[model samples]
Target: MTTWNLNGMKHHLFFCNGGSCTKKGAEEVVEAMRDEIKLQEADVRIHTTRTRCQGRCEDACVITVYPEGVWYKEVTPEIGRRIVREHLVGGSPVEEHISYTYEDELAARPDTKEGQSKTKRKEAQTK
Candidate 1:
């Protein structure tokens, strides 16, 4: 097995650049985030990643901040900057834009039977 090291990084920001997210301006968000991080001078501490898909297309332009496992959805360029400045630089997550936590993502695994059952139940209730 290959060992991967984080080089003492405190946080990892993953910006989804998949099909849906791309259409929603994921690239612009990435640029804005990078600019904000640079302006805040936190480039050495936080790592940024561009990923293909996070399996949350409905919430396209999704951004996941790891180590804390915070997931923000429908992120625009402005929100991306806030994520860098507020969450990464200030050490406080911007709670208003958060769609779910890492725990919520795990529990909503649509591929699993339990998850599917829950989804169906929720749909039924709505109908």
Candidate 2:
């Protein structure tokens, strides 16, 4: 049973860096997000991840915000920065750039806090 605990962190931001997305400005989005996160240094709590393929190639330059599962597409460097500041940091999902979404995850499962798999977590615990 893959039970995802639902009462953990606040937000999880996953940016897709697959080849298609990269050609579509995913790299710039990544850089912008990094810079913006450094600038805010907030206490609201958020996790940022660089994912492989999110399977939304039409929206190649895509970022998926977890808990919310709010997918923003056609992201430019500028939009990425704004999303960090406004949504990830300020607790508001930027609506203007939203493409696809599945909010059910937000209510049902808590994200794994990024950067690790369940096996990795178990290994760390064992060590």
lDDT of 1 by residue, 1-127 (tens): 1216667678888999999999999999999998888888777788888899999898888999988787788899999999898888887878767766555345433443445434565687799
Cα distance off (Å), candidate 1, residue 102: 3.6
Determine which window of 10 residues in candidate 1 has minimal summed lDDT. Answer: 108-117
Question: Between which residue pairs do clashes occur in model 2?
Answer: none
User: Taking the candidates one at a time, how many backbone clashes does each contain?
Assistant: 0, 0
Q: Which stretches of candidate 1 lie over 4 Å from their true place?
A: 1-6, 103-127
- TM-score against truth, every candidate: 0.75, 0.69
TM-score attained by model 2? 0.69
> How high is the CA lDDT of each candidate model?
0.81, 0.73
By lDDT, the best candidate is 1
